[model samples]
Target: MSQPSSRPELTPRFCFNQTALRDFLRLSRSTIDDSITQNLNALLTPSTTAFNPTSTSTRSVTPPSSSRAIPAQTCTSFKHNVLFPSWASRSDVLDYCAGVATSPDPDDPDSVLRQIEDEKVRERVVDERLDPYSGRYFPREARTESLAMLMRNERMVEKVVRARTGSVVGERCGEGGGLEGEFDEWRRAQGSGRR
Candidate 1:
């Protein structure tokens, strides 16, 4: 056998798909229905009105689908509780931010500090959970992501911001309005923390 090189060649890896998993575990529609019935009896109730066994008048309750057709407000609440725990409620967040915005001077050091804390809270909420199943925010904080993918996404965000603002450096382009001073203060505060 030839001597192995200092750096071994990387080989691609394969993961089993869901269909393969189901086949391996012998999962079928009947099994899935049974599991669902066991798991969601409170949510899915069958009509229990008694009739003659010979009569076909027995009614059944249909289970809600995974689509979760609940209202947007309900979904937002679920996201707040399950996906975001940093800021309490959306209204509270908005009020706090508005209070900071309407301050005598947004560029004030104290107000900048408060805004930085608020942004840090928001960042924690977003980064803590990433749901792969629904391709939405996942509540499991321990789950990790690839560094390369994270870098790519960060670069993409920088590109989008540049495209929107039309400036990678220099003073605000007039459209940013008076908020520019507040933004600069916030960025300075963030940068100072690292040093």
Candidate 2:
């Protein structure tokens, strides 16, 4: 087709024009980067699923029954988990013990952990506040945050029992001390699962 020869033929031809090629390459790079990041995160994340897999929605699932109050060592302690152990920030420690989360820096909450100079102090924060691990019954509990709250409450109750010389379901010292240490004794009880 030889119509008007006004156009020059020196221009390089490409399936995608320069602007289109730039956009396409950028999109491709972003997609590849996202896929790689997701794969890496998958490797780090735990592979466990919820106990109730058949449920259509999370809201529909029933919650587990409340656990018996556990010992302070088996739960969170304000001195170890919340503040500096050496009574450095006494006021902040007081508030933290009363369930108030006080960040080291008013502007940035993350500075709370960053401000700790001692390795032991930082380790406590990491082991308790940052990642308060569940112990024996961790397998049954799926939600970490929920487990953390339960631990906190259990500790609080245990503290009260210690301070006031009270009794709790787990620490039933008021009922002539706790469970009798006889093998198959719990099985004899009507309510116990072993029965």
Candidate 3:
């Protein structure tokens, strides 16, 4: 019998399919609801893997040192689990409607219940969008940010500022800090050279 080749053959390079990649990342198509919200970085960030856990890649990522706690009432809307009068239990509402709908000739029970359930699901989805930390589905276009997009933009700004100024002393850049200075310098230099 002929002997097999000692070296393994390499495969040709292939392009990444972003749609497939997002699906693999557990981000569904429904996640892109609004134009302002769905930017590139949101698709690439691995959800539920905030920090690297591998032994070789372990690194310390400290939380903010401030001890202040965010107030719970800061959230705009409150949903009480037990106290919400509008919260109808499926059985109670269904049983009540059962008598009204199927009786003689009034209405259809299943259609009404289905419509209510659909509305409830939509309401829950909207509520989920309000809670960014929940990891519940928020379509990209619906909000101005996904956690990853915000992180990526912050990093990019930091890198550019660091590159231009070579200064790491200041806190996060303010609105009209070195960034505006750098831009003005560039415009001046360009104008001077044009003459």
Candidate 4:
């Protein structure tokens, strides 16, 4: 047998597509339906109602003629929970957002979302969930996003001030303008620890 090479072979690694994971991170906790959350840890978690085969035969030369089943319905407990594409018709999504919108301020990070009276802006927010199943955001998403504005706005203000005034500002003596609370969660997710 030939001697083994000193260097290991370079090989590509594969991972699951990020479509679902993107939604998991981007989606506000409110958007996760209660029905799904209730059974999330169980062996057979509750799922939105869908029809037809969800998996496709990748071995085929061409795309499968049939499409994956789309969820037909979602949780009924919360008006803000939208898990399926078909769940948010009749302008319910827009209406829900409008109803929940708080007073907008220029310094608020969520001012952009709160100020979305234009149809184009609203459409973009609704369509960008990136989940194949839902691709939508409900009122709860708007609320959760708005709550995070305090920290986001602070960063933006500092950036703008530094650019125009040529001076740093908004110092809080080591306080991160509320970002400290997220540190633990972020670090945990990143899996960094003392070794």
Most accurate candidate by lDDT: 1
The TM-score values for the models, in the order shown, are 0.16, 0.16, 0.18, 0.15
Residue pairs whose backbone atoms clash in candidate 1: 131-138
lDDT score, residue 177, model 3?
A: 39
Error of 2 at 38 (Å): 2.2
Report the alpha-carbon TM-score of model 3 versus the true structure: 0.18
- Model 3 Cα lDDT, one tens digit per residue, 79-164: 11211111112112223333333334223234556566656656764444677665444332211122234334434543453333
Worst 10 residues of 2 by lDDT: 1-10
Runs in model 1 with CA error above 4 Å? Answer: 1-145, 166-184, 190-195
RMSD of each: 26.8, 31.0, 26.6, 26.6
CA lDDT of each prediction against the hidden true structure: 0.31, 0.29, 0.29, 0.29
Q: In candidate 3, residue 23 scores what lDDT?
A: 34
Q: Kindly report which residue stretches of model 2 are placed more than 4 angstroms away from their true locations once superposed.
A: 1-12, 42-46, 49-195
lDDT at 41 for candidate 1? 27
* Model 4, position 192: C-alpha lDDT score: 58
lDDT of 4 by residue, 1-195 (tens): 011112212111100122332232224222322223232222122455664364454444653322221122211112122222212221132233233334332344454655563445456634345665554444424433443343244335433432321111012111123322332354354355433
| Model 2 per-residue lDDT tens digits across residues 1-195 | 011111112112211133432343234323322232232222232435756666656464443322222334422232122211111222122223323222122443334444443333435423345455621121222222333353355445433433332123223211333322211242244236444
